[model samples]
Structure formats: structure tokens, C-alpha cells
Target: MATETFLASFGLVGLRLIERHGIDPAHFARELGIPSTALPDARTRLPSALLDSAFEKAARCIPDPAFALGAAECWHPSHLGTLGYAWLSSGSLRTALKRMARYTKTLGQRMSSRCVETPEGLQFIYDHGRGDTLTGWVMADFGLSLIVSLCRTNDGTDLAPALVTLRRPTPATIRPYEDFFGGPVRFGETHDGLLLSWQVADRPLPTSNRELATTCDAILASELATLQNDDLESRCRAHLLHELTSGEPSDTRLAESLGLSTRTLQRKLAALGLSYRGLLEKTRYELALRYLDDPKKSVTEITFLLGFSEQSAFTRAFKRWNGKAPSDYRQSPGS
Candidate 1:
């Protein structure tokens, strides 16, 4: 059974905000039974219950109801470990957000988030998957505001979500949220999320760095694999997902990225009844289906995205994976 928890680095961010408002950081940590030493290590794990208590306590001691939103300003690229850097270097807001959705579980065990395409734009929804409490409310505020902040940081356009939705009832004052998000906010809704217009979501950011983003993404996948129980196969698949956009990764390249020799990597896979080619094929097949779902991408674009040398090769593989061609599969009834 996985226990709910948050990365200690997040706790550190919250504590710093508490201290900025005149609370003693040491005292806060001590009250929550957190070791002073643990606060300095980004890799440390903090119990979600402790964080919940800390937020509840902060809500009581702090005069402002929106104090947790201060975390939006406090975040640094280091705060989220590798994911933060990966986000900073992402090609676009859409890519960064997808990275967040994929790896948020590494930040908090209970952080369940997704990005859905809607006619209006991309909707990023985050549900902590816990009962309503002061902690949940605080986290919701922090989570939403922090996303906006990150977008502004990388985009340099002060980009605001098209709209904001919340499960919580309307607060005593909506000014703070509206002011923080720089747009209209809807409360008492069925979900908690932000809607980003496609224009801003897909726009190329000035901070885009394909090389660095790819590097950080690889590390994040490896870290996620560790958090998910050190599964080498999972690690391989995750790494491949990030690498596919660049090109089909050779076994030597993949093994070197994972800090293993090619022979060792193959030996380990064989022991588990797996093969490098089989995993690569599976990865490409899975990604092909996802890309095909998006009509914006042409078959040629998807061919390169899947690291295939030509459209013919991809079509052949698609035929093998499914009984029909990619176009046929996409147009078939239900598809």
C-alpha cells in the first residue's frame, strides 16, 4: 500500500513562506516533528499528514486566508528537483504541463493531475484525491497559483489561464484569486483546474532549450522509476517516451543514458524475459496511437516523431500492430 506523501522540498518551500510571514521556521518544523536537517535535503520524503497539519496550523496562525498562495513566488527550479528544470527548458507550455502531469506523482504521492484537450483549450486539472479540509484547500490554492507563476516565468508574457475552476465554494472574497490568476475564476464547480487557450499553451517559449529539456526529462523518468520501485523496465519505457521525439535511440545510447553498458542492459532485460527491440517496438506503438489521436499531426510528422526513417516504415509497423493501416485505424467506427 502506498502511503500519501509529498517531496520534502515542497515542505521546505511552505516553511519558508511561513517564516516570511513572521512564523519561526524551526518552531514550525519542530511542532510537525520534522527534523531540522531534513529541510535541507530535496530528496527527503515528508508525510502528507504532517504537511496537512502544517497547512492547518498555518491557516490558524496566519491572518491571511490566501497565505499558501505565496508559494507561487517562492518556487525555484531546484524546488521540484529535476522536473523543475525540465519544465524550465520545455519547448512550450503544453509540453511543460504534460511533463508535470506525468511526473506529479513523484512530487506528491496523491497528486492526481491530467491535461485534457477541449474545444476552448487545454484543461489542466489537479485533484489531490483527499477529502475536503483546510489542507486540501491550501494545496489547491498553491497548486493553481504555482502553475500560473511557472507559466509566467518561462513564457515572459504574464500568461493567464483562460479560466479557473474550483470545487470549493465561493470564498468570502474572490479578488485575491482573480488578482493572482489574472483572469476570471469560477468557484463551486465540479472540478479544480485551469483552462489555457491553445494559443498560449502551444506557443514556443523564449526559454525553450531542446537539449536541456531532453536531459532533464530523462533524469525525471529515471527518478520516477526509482519512486515506483526501481523497475528497470519502467525506467526504460519512460526514457524512451522522452527520447522518441529526437529519434529512435540505439541500444548503446539508451544504455549509456541509464548508466549501464549495452551488454549489462541486454542481460538484465533477458533475465526478465524482455528484449531491447521488443521494448522499443512497444514504446513506438504506444506513442503512435497517442499521436494519431491528435488530428493536428500529419502522418509524416508522426513518422518523424516516432523516430521512423520514412512513412512507409511507420505504416508497415502500424499495420503489424493493428490489422489495418494507421489512417484506417483512425477513421474506423469508434476511433
Candidate 2:
């Protein structure tokens, strides 16, 4: 089985910040086991360990232990591609967050986000199992800062979290976090997340473009369907695993990857009582449980990895397949 990977984009943002401070990104990447050439593509799927390694190396070179906070200061919706557009046009911060939690896989495949409502307000959680290394600390900061920054943008005003929580211990001085988030910071929590007042989520986005959001949704939906409509079962599985790991899942791409005519491919699968759709369903079910077993991937991430259009789609399918939701299966004393 392949070791799980993460979107290198999050770290790439930090690398640029390091270089902006006068250090060469290539040299930094080399110190972290990534070729400088390999560092440019934000969408590249790298061993999650490489990001952790790079973050640690970056800490030794940069003066600030909390450089991740600074890097997030440069974040913009455009950095996220379609996911960003979907957010920009969302009807409200709450709706935008729903979109973010749903499609975060497009930004970081192994990263999972959850948004829940509480009496206190809205809580957004960013969870990645990067351990206690400097990379882990930076990633936690980066994730927290990114979302809070987003919340600020969504409201078109300066804002802060009601409470910021980190799984790691408090840094030597909690001032950086408190200063950056403009709120109280709490460490040694079981998870990494930040909270916002309920009002922040309920307000409408001035830039909300429902038509564009719908268009992006359609495009994403088409991509998901394409993954399930492709060539021979054996070749389809090979192509799905290889390209879908980092690229969009498309039937034309799969056929090209297998060097088969689309018609010819259809005939081949039919030879074995297989349909592309059937193969996709079986393959997704097979891979879903496997990916979920890893603490590194949240249920949301596994849904996208398995080519389901949405997390709910994966859950419904899982229920049909095993008579229980994925969470129920995984959380059981024995999966």
C-alpha cells in the first residue's frame, strides 16, 4: 500500500516566505529532502514527512519560531484555485465554511476540517497528525492562521477567534499567537482549532456569486463522475490509484494513461461483466476503509480520495455497502 501524502501547497507558501527573507528556497528544499524543482508545484503530493522535515529545517533558518503565522499573513482566496472561488461566492461565512470543510481535500488531501455550531459560537477545527516536531507546530499554526485569516476576509473587517486551541504545549511566550489571532490562546488541547462568534458566520458575503459557485460545483461534480467512468477494471484501478492520488479523476485522462481508445476500453471491461461505474464503486469502497484506518486522514479526506463527490456521498455509499456509516465502522472497537 502507498504511504498517504499531503498537498505540498501549504508548505510552498512558507517556502516563499523564507526566500522573501533572503534565503534560497532550493537550498532549503535540499536540506529537507525535496528537490528545488519538485518544490514549485503546489499541488504536488509529497510524503507528509517531507513537509514536516521542511518545516523543521525552516525553523532553524528563520528567526521566528512562529513563522507560519507570518506566512498566513500572505494568504488569499486565489491560492486555493477552484476551492477558493467556491468560497468567494458563498452566500455567507457559514456556507463558505461548509464549502471549505467539504472541499479542503482539493487544497490538502490529508488535511481534514470540521465546522460545528455550539452555544458559544462556531468552531472550526484543522486536524493533521504531524506529531510534535517543529513541522507539526508550524502546520498547526498555519492551519489556524489560514482559517482565521479567511474569517477576517469573509467579514471585511478585523476579527479574532473567541478561543484558539493547539494540541501542543504553549510556546515559550503565548504572545505571538495571542497577538496574531487577537484573542486568548489555549494550548494542550486534544485538537487544533479556533472559534468565532456566531455573528461572524451568519453575515452575508458582499462578493457572493451564486452562479459562479454553482458552476464550480458542476465542474467538480463532473470530475468526480469521470473518475468512475473509464477503461478496463485492471487498468482503471491502476490509473485511478496513480493519477487520482494527486490529479483530477477524469475518464479521458484515464484512457490516455492506459493508451486505449475509449470505445475499445468500454468493450474490454464489458468482456468481464464489468462496467466502469461498477469498478469505481468497488474500488472506492475498497480504498475508503483502508484510507480511513490511518489517523493521518480524516473521514472527509478519505471521501475525496475515494473519488466520491462529497463526504455525504461516501457516507451514504458506505451505509449501502456495509449497513453502517464509515465512522461507525472505523470507531467500532474492531474495524
Candidate 3:
């Protein structure tokens, strides 16, 4: 299976910062095992481990302790791919922050983000499974600084967080931390996170553009889906989704689409303790729920979309999967 990776746009941001500090990014790239060519392509995926190593190398070689904080200055929405655009067009900081937590996988699977409500404000917590080490502090700072920068970019205000906490111990100099966060900085905290008062998070932004946000949301969803389906089973399901509208995709057609012989495809599925028929059923069920979510798609239309010969057949499959009829499930998706 492919290793967890992130888009190269982030590395590019770091490279730009490196060059700004009078260091050669190419030298750092070679040391970090990153291809010089990969730095310019936003969509190129690089291993997550390399990102951690990059921060570590920078901490060792860079004279400035807070150099990673400059990530905000070099950041552009395009670096984050679709998620960046989705965040830019969000109506409010709350919406934008939640979208970051939601589609974070598009950046790197190892990192996870969450927004929690509190008496003081909304707390945005991020864990990339590396905040305990000395070098990890740089990564944490990079993340928090980028958040503040993106907020300023969209809201056109020097919005400050209510509070900021880093798991790393206090550095020799602290002014940079306070200036970047625009709030009180506390060190040696349980989590590397920041808090935004509800007033700031929920207030509508002047940059609010629902049409663009919605378009970006769809693209982000698609990007995430493609990123997640790296295995053979998922590859088959993706091909099946495109072919389903024509009819039930035969194993022969699917195998051909995947550049495999029918017998070879069957053998491979069996090795993984799966079957071709089972894959088709699961793919149809997955697509069925998505189609049902569209109120405009009638049951009959969705039936054909799943390549079912009859509405009754689709209904039976839907019920078998969810223990509820398609219409009922659509009405109460949580059920």
C-alpha cells in the first residue's frame, strides 16, 4: 500500500521561507530526501515522514529558533489544494475552521484537527502524532501560525486568538510567539492548540462567498475520496462507479479497465479474502447512499444509476445494507 503523504505545496512554503532566510532550499531538499522537482508541484505527494524530518533539519541548521513561524508569510490557499479554496470562501471562521478539521486528510493522513466548544471560546486542537519531541515544537508552531495567517488573509483583520498553548517548553525568546498568535502564549500545555472567542469564530467574514465555498467543498470531497482509495479494492470501486450508469459492470470489463485478465482479477480478490461480486454490491450500496442524499434524484432514477434492472431490486439492496428503505433512510440519514 502507498504510504501516508501530503501535497508538496506545504514543502514549497517551507522552501520559500528557507530562501527568504538566505539559505539554499535545494540543499535542504537534498538533506530531507525531497526531490527538488517536487517542490514546485502543488499536487505532488511526499511521504509524511519527510515533513517531520524537514522540520528537524531546519531546527538543527537554522539559526533562528522561531523560523518556522514564517510559514504564514509564505502560505497561499493553493498550497492546501481544494481545502484552501474551501476555507477562503467560508462564511465565518467557525465554518472555515471546521472545514479544516473535516478535510485535513487531503493534506496529510497522519494529522487530525478538531474544534471544541468551551465556556471561554472555541478551541481548535491539532495532533499530528509528533508534538512531544523538541523538533515537533517547530511543526506545531508552523501549524498554529498558518491558522492565524489564513484567518487574517480571509477576514482582513488582525484577529487575535483568546489564548495559545504549546506542548513545547518555553523558548529563550517569547515575543515572537505572542506577536504571531496575537494573544497570551502559554508553554508546557497538554495540547498544542489555540482558542478563539466564539464572537470571532462565529462572526461572518467580509470575504464570505457561499457559491465559491460550495464549489470548493465538492472538489475537496472528491480530492479526499481519491486520496483515500489507494488500495486495489478501492480502485475497483472507483472504476465501478463510473461504469455503473451504463449497466452492471461485468468482471471482465472491470478487469480490462484495470489492465488485468478476468482469472487474474478473481485470483487477486480471493487472495485478499474478497470476491468480485461482493465488491460490486458494496460499491453500489456506497453510491446508493450518495445518490439518495440528492433530493432531486428519485428512487427510480437512483435505481438505474446503481444499474439495477428494477426499482424493487434497488430497494431490496438498500434495505439489506441499512435495515431501512431508501426513502426512509433519506428522510433520516442518521438511522
- Across residues 53-119, which tens digit of lDDT does each residue of candidate 2 receive? 7677777777877777876666555466567677777666776776677556556545778888899
Instruction: Quote each prediction's TM-score.
Output: 0.72, 0.62, 0.69
Q: Report per-prediction Cα RMSD to one decimal.
A: 8.9, 12.3, 7.5
Candidate 1: where is the Cα deviation over 4 Å? 37-39, 230-335
C-alpha lDDT (0 to 100) for residue 49 of candidate 3: 89
Error of 1 at 320 (Å): 14
Ten residues in sequence with the least summed lDDT for candidate 2 = 222-231
| Candidate closer to the true structure by TM-score (higher is better), 1 or 3 | 1
**lDDT score of residue 313 within candidate 3:** 91
Task: After the best TM-score superposition of candidate 2, give how far the Cα of residue 274 lies from its true spot, in angstroms.
Answer: 26
* Residue 80 C-alpha lDDT in model 3: 81
What candidate 2 gets wrong by more than 4 Å, as runs, is 33-44, 219-335
Residue pairs in candidate 1 whose N, alpha carbon or C atoms collide under 3 angstroms:
none
RMSD of 3: 7.5
Pairs of residues at least 3 apart in sequence or in different chains that clash in candidate 3: none
lDDT agreement with native, every candidate: 0.81, 0.69, 0.81
Residue 164 Cα positional deviation in candidate 3, in Å, after optimal superposition: 0.7
